[model samples]
Each structure stands twice: as C-alpha cells, then as structure tokens.
Target: MLKIRLKKKCKKLCHAVIAGICISGSLLTTSLLAAELGYPEKEELTFGFIKLTDMAPIAIAYEKGFFEDEGLYVTIEAQANWKVLLDGVIDGRLDGAHMLAGQPIAATIGYGTKAEIITPFSMDLNGNAITVSNEIWAQMKGNIPKQADGKPVHPIKADALKPVVEKYLDAGKPFNMGMVFPVSTHNYELRYWLAAGNIHPGFYAPHKGDTSGKINAQALLSVTPPPQMPATMEAGTIYGYCVGEPWNQQAVFKGIGVPVVTDYEIWKNNPEKVFGITKAFSEKYPNTTIRLTRALIRAAKWLDENDNANRPEAVKILSQSNYVGADREVIANSMTGTFEYEKGDKRAVPDFNVFFRYNATYPYYSDAIWYLTQMRRWGQISEDKPDSWYKDVAAKVYRPDIYMAAAQSLVADKLLLKSDFADLVDEDGYREPQKHFIDNIVYDGTAPNDYINKFKIGLKAGDKL
Candidate 1:
C-alpha cells in the first residue's frame, strides 16, 4: 500500500494550506475597507446648480453613476443665478453649490460675500412657492376665504395679501415684490410671508448704509433671477414672487401667476436647499469631502426610494437640456407629487419635492438654526446674537460632522441600511422643537433668542435698524 499512499498525500497538502489562508484573510478585509473609504483625495469634480427642481441631489448624483460609485468623477453645471451660484462656490469656480438655505447662512454671517461657507448636505424639502400677478390674483380674490366649493381655501394666507398691500399703499403705488437673492431662501420666504401679513416686509439698514431692504416700508422686496421669475412677472417687473421649482410651475403655466403659498404652507418641514462648500473645500478634500458626501447620500437615497418610484425617472432627469431646463409638463407640475394652484387647481402635494424623506439628507443644527433665525429676524443679522451666538453660527454652517461621515460610509458599504440611518445615529444636531409656522410660532432651535423674540414682525430683543 506504499505506506497508505503517504498518509493520503499529507492530507492533500494540509487542505491546500488552509485554503490559501482563507483567501488572504478575505483580501485583507477588502483592503482595510478600501483604506477606510479614503481614496478620493480629489477626483475630477465640478458641481454647481440653479435651474431648480431642488437641483435634484446634484442632478441625481450626476445621472446615477452615484459619482462613479464614490470613486467620483462629477461635473454638473447650470448656474446663472443664486448669485452665480454663490459666486461659483466662493471663487473656486464651483467645486460645490446648489445652495440657498440662505446662502450658507448669509455667507457665514458677514452678510453677503464674506465666505467661510459650509453645508455638508440638506438639499430638498418643500420646493417653494408664493407666485402672484394675474393682477395680484385678482386683487387677492376679494380677500380670500372660501371653502364649501367656492375654492380658494388652502394655505393661502399672508392674511390674504394684506388688503392688496393696503390697496397699493392707498394708490401711491410702490408695492413691488420678487425675491430670489439678498441671501435667499427666496429672501426668507418672502420675508416670512410679508411679515405674516401685518406686511412691513422691509428693513436691512445694513447699519445705515441701507442695502435697500427698503428701510421701514411695506412690501418692496427685489432681486428676480429664478429663470427671470415668469419673465420678471411678465414684464411689469415683479408684482409677486418667492421662487423654486419650474418658477412656481412657470407661473401656473403662463396664465402668468398665482401660486399663493407653499414653503410647505410656510414652515412644515422647512429647510430648503443646501450642499455648499468652501471651508477650504472641506479642509482640502477630506477624502474628497467624504466622497462627495457619499455621492450625495446615494443621490438622496435614489430620490426618496420606492415611494417616489424614482420620480418619473427624476422628472425625466430634471427636464433635460442640462438639468432643470423646465417643461416636462413644467417639471411634472411639481416633480411628480402635484401642485398646480389656479389653472385647474391640482393638489396632492406629496411632500412637494423632498428628495429623501424626513431625514431629508440631515444637516440639521436645527436646520442651521432656522436659517440663523431668519438672519436675526431679518436685519440680516445686524446685531443681537448670543443664543450662544445662535449655536456658534449653527455649528459653523451645518456640517453634521461631514453629514455623519458620509452617512457612516454608506453604513459600512452595505451601500446604506442601518435602518437607512436611524435619525443619523444619535443625532443631537437639534430638531424636535419646530412647530410649523405661518405664525403659529414655536421654533426652539435651542432657543434662538427665544425664536427671535417670537416675531410679531421681525427684529426683537434690543432690536436695531
């Protein structure tokens, strides 16, 4: 028996050396988790966006390659507005953009162009509304208040356009309106719906040099850009505006205007737009800023996963011709939920255009302290700070520790699922106090000057301007 075939050929060479040491310890544990997801030290990125539809998670992470599956190769351009996309992400010709949750807290509190800018990600929430002109909705349709089928009932309050802006200031007329910038979240939701209808939508003495927020007035507002907001109110020049999304469904599809109200009825789930950069481009591309925020959190979880059913293929890739060129039925009337208001009144606003359900791409330091308490209740932060300076300028412009280190490296590469980020694992980055405004008040972001002293119409607590 040749010594029993040499002990079965030495037990077949000791089971092929223990199966090659368990496949080299499973490829060195996937090369140390791909060196702890740290390969992109900067990989050909461009990014910038303005043409709206909530810039759909940077155009669905550059049309779904999810920035080449985190190896990154993004480009995405389109920007003729939001101050040339926050001056092309503060002069680097945009390595990041799609901004305006008050353009990185009014460019990190210096008010306009002083940039330290940061926003790890919080793009998409209620898309925005407030259109007007069809002669100010037929003089605000006889002070709106109808329901038992007369129609105009929903959330249409700015207290019914304050007696048609006090009958155009008793016919002396300078009522104007439009807001796309001046540190826009459409200029603080059109100055919080014209100061919740008492109407003095003015101020911003900018310490007396008056950056023309029309010092002590009643609805002057300005700046227009958003695809020339319905051709600047169909050429009469801004009778009303507060944009976002196919320019308020291209002013109810060109009958020229009438959206009336929908920053989710002014505050329910607020926080609109963010993804800015330039805090030295996230400290010189820390793993290319967590691999482009893990390819915009997997393109905002594939644009709010199944419930949106990929939003008619992301409203046919934001109506093509280079993202949000509008008209794919005016961006599916509201990126496929339903919102037409006043041209055959469509309704079911399924969270309007929230690119990812409630954690809506979490960058919540109470949504940057409710946009820095609406930039200190709209004198654009000219004074009264210290609610610990609004939580240290909302933890230095809402980083959320680089959005939970790109959502915990996409839940350790299982490509997301840790209950798809259980409220971003121990999120103390505030929230929970928001009570949905349009005047019901209650904001709390750990008390921003007692929510700017409960705005009975802006500035409080030793008010200035």
Candidate 2:
C-alpha cells in the first residue's frame, strides 16, 4: 500500500476539509517504507485550470487524496480562459496550471508572454475533436464516406470539410472557425487538419503585428475559450471549432454540431495539455515540485488504471460546478472511452483520453519540439529556427528530470510497477519517428526543420514573414 508515516507535529492542529479530505494543517508525510525524499518547502498551493475534461488529473489528484498524501494542501481554480490561467501562473497568483502544450514553449521562446515557464508533466493525450456547426455539418456530411451500416466512416478527415469551406469561399463568404487559444493544441490541430486537406487555415505573421492568423486564409481562425466554443458556433460567430472534451460532446447533445474529426485522427496519440509552473518555482521548491509531480503521476495512474475503470468516478468529480461543470452524460460521452459524432453515432475510441498509459505523463522533449514545429509551421514563430534551436528550447522548458525524480520515487515506494515505464529506458527524451499523423507524413522530432519543410500549407525553413 506504499506505507508512509505521518509525523505528528501538531500543537493546535484542527481538522479542516480540503478537497473533501480533513488533514492536520497539511502535515508532512515521512517515508517509513522507502527513503524520505524530503519535505515540501511550501505546502499550501493553488493551481489553475480551464474547465475542460483534460484538467482531470489536477482534479483527481486533489479529490483522491494524492495531494494530501504528499503533505500538500491544494486549491484548484477554474480560470476564465487560457490567457488568464497562464497569467495567473506567471504573476504568482497561481502556483501552477493545466496549460496548453504550446503555452510554456511559446512563453519560453517569447512568442506571446515571455516567461520561464516549465512543465514536468504532460497531462493527457488526444482528448480534442473538431466540430462543425449544424449548417456546416449539413454541407460536409454529404462528402464524407460511409460504412456499410450507413454510419459515417470513422476518423472523418478534413477532406470531408474541404468542399464546404471551398463553397463558402466561392460565394465570397468568410468561413470563420474557433479554437481555444492562439497557442493552444486546438488551434494547431485545427490548422494541421485543415491544411492537410488542401484548405488554407492561414498564418499569423506575428513579426508584423499580424496576430490575427488570417493572412491569405481560406478559413479564418480565432481564439475562443473551450467552454464557449459550442455556444459561439451556435450563435454563428464561427462555423466550426476544435476543442477538448465535454465541449465537443456538448455540441452533439445540444444538436448544434457534429464532430467531424478527433485530434487522434489528425495526429494519433498527440500531446495535449501540460502541467505548467515557472522554472524558478521548480528550482526554489525542489522537493515540493517533485512531490507535486508524484501526486499527479499517481493520480494519472489511478484515472487510467484497469482500462479506465475509474473514469465514471472521475466524471463525477469533473462534473461538479467548481470543476468542468458539464453534465455527467456529456463528460462521460468522451471520458468513458467512446465519443459521439453525428448524433447516435458514438464509436469506440479507447485511447481518447489516455493518461498514464503509453507513458503519457512523462514530459518528453520530443513532445515540446512537436509543439514548436507546429508553431513555426503556422507562422506563430514568424521565422525559421534551426533544429538545434528547437532542441534547446525543448530542453529548457520540458523538464524530464523532475518527472523521473517523481516517477522513480513512486517505484521505490512501491506505488507503481517499474515495468509500467519500460519505454523510458535509455530514453533520449525523444520518441521514435512517429508516422501516425493523418497526412501520412512522418515526424521525427530530432529534425524539426525537416518536419516543418514537409508541410505544404504553412511556413518552412527560411520562410520569413
């Protein structure tokens, strides 16, 4: 059971409910089963998140006593949007946050807000899907291939959406779409899917004060918060959007849109949100950082354990008004290993919200590099950077050292099996050349420039704004 001793140091300690657990002023738990990793320097911490199901790890960590187990008293807050969440972490108002994968990388490289944000944990994988409004879907559905039973073929690509976009363009109409943030996985994934289908989603040209991302675009894309995506599209503010779970699922339940594609289809097992904190915070509170990472890792394990036997419970926690606040049915639609596309067309997608499995929690340099490559491709980077630049920036932001420190401690403490991380042995912080992308292009993170140059619709090497 990974036994540890709680050292009694209470002079006037009283029980107080924290994330539904009563604790002794957040006492330090000493290791009686393994070597003590040292106590957290700062225990009372507040983390921020957007109300998406991908923020489940932070919620699970607190709800399942994982945070309390590490002697950390944690408060989880739902921010207004991605920008506010990142701002909170930067201004020390938030200890950390469930941030977009590109947020930390963009911050480190001075794309948007300049900061030294770092991530020791990659939260979850492949929870996002692209949804088109009912009007757009009606136009797109006719072009999509169908199965024998008359269901639309799975992994419905942007190719199906291409004709509808072209029709709008032919009529001299602006086909607008929404993504969560400028640097969000949703934005990049939407861009990737649109571009792969020969549709121009457009560029940023951020070097020339053109952050609108619609220079010569076939479909104009803009930032909308995750929770607001469906409503915005319903109002016809956008024709479609790419966003995370419950929200995409919400569109189906509300009968306003149909999710045409999931990011898993665009790029299989793609990296999603990350647990982000300032680089200075990690160095200043080394023990606290590792302990918090450990708690998160364990929470991820529990959530993905037994082929997601814990997801219904997780959906309950996430459905609470303070968390994701979506209905349990909507959250469960994706969280429970199946996703509804066209209404009544739910399909099995077991890897839709992978957490601990496939080494999903480990903060890989390759993952960071992939996000950087997307940024450069979409003109968010505004200029060419060498392969080494990508590698250096990845190393600066994605800290596997902290992740491993926490993971090894869990193994030593007998919480997780060593076999659980077999792929990490002699790891060079990069995955092998991944070929699962829907475009049929292989991405070797070791060579970012080569990958960027392979794209047809966006910026490449030496392609200046």
TM-score, per-candidate, Cα-based = 0.36, 0.94
Worst 10 residues of 1 by lDDT: 1-10
Candidate 1: clashing pairs of residues: none
Top lDDT model:
2
Error of 1 at 371 (Å): 14
Model 1 segments more than 4 A misplaced: 1-28, 31-100, 118-122, 125-142, 145-148, 153-160, 164-188, 191-200, 207-216, 219-260, 263-271, 276-278, 288-292, 307-346, 356-465
For candidate 2, the TM-score is: 0.94
lDDT of 2: 0.88
lDDT of 2 by residue, 5-82 (tens): 223234332333222223445644345532368767787788998889999998888877888777687777889988
How well is each residue in 104-167 modelled by candidate 1, as lDDT tens digits?
8777877768889988888878888888889889988878888897888888888888998898
Question: Against the true structure, whose TM-score is highest?
Answer: 2
Clashes of 2: 0
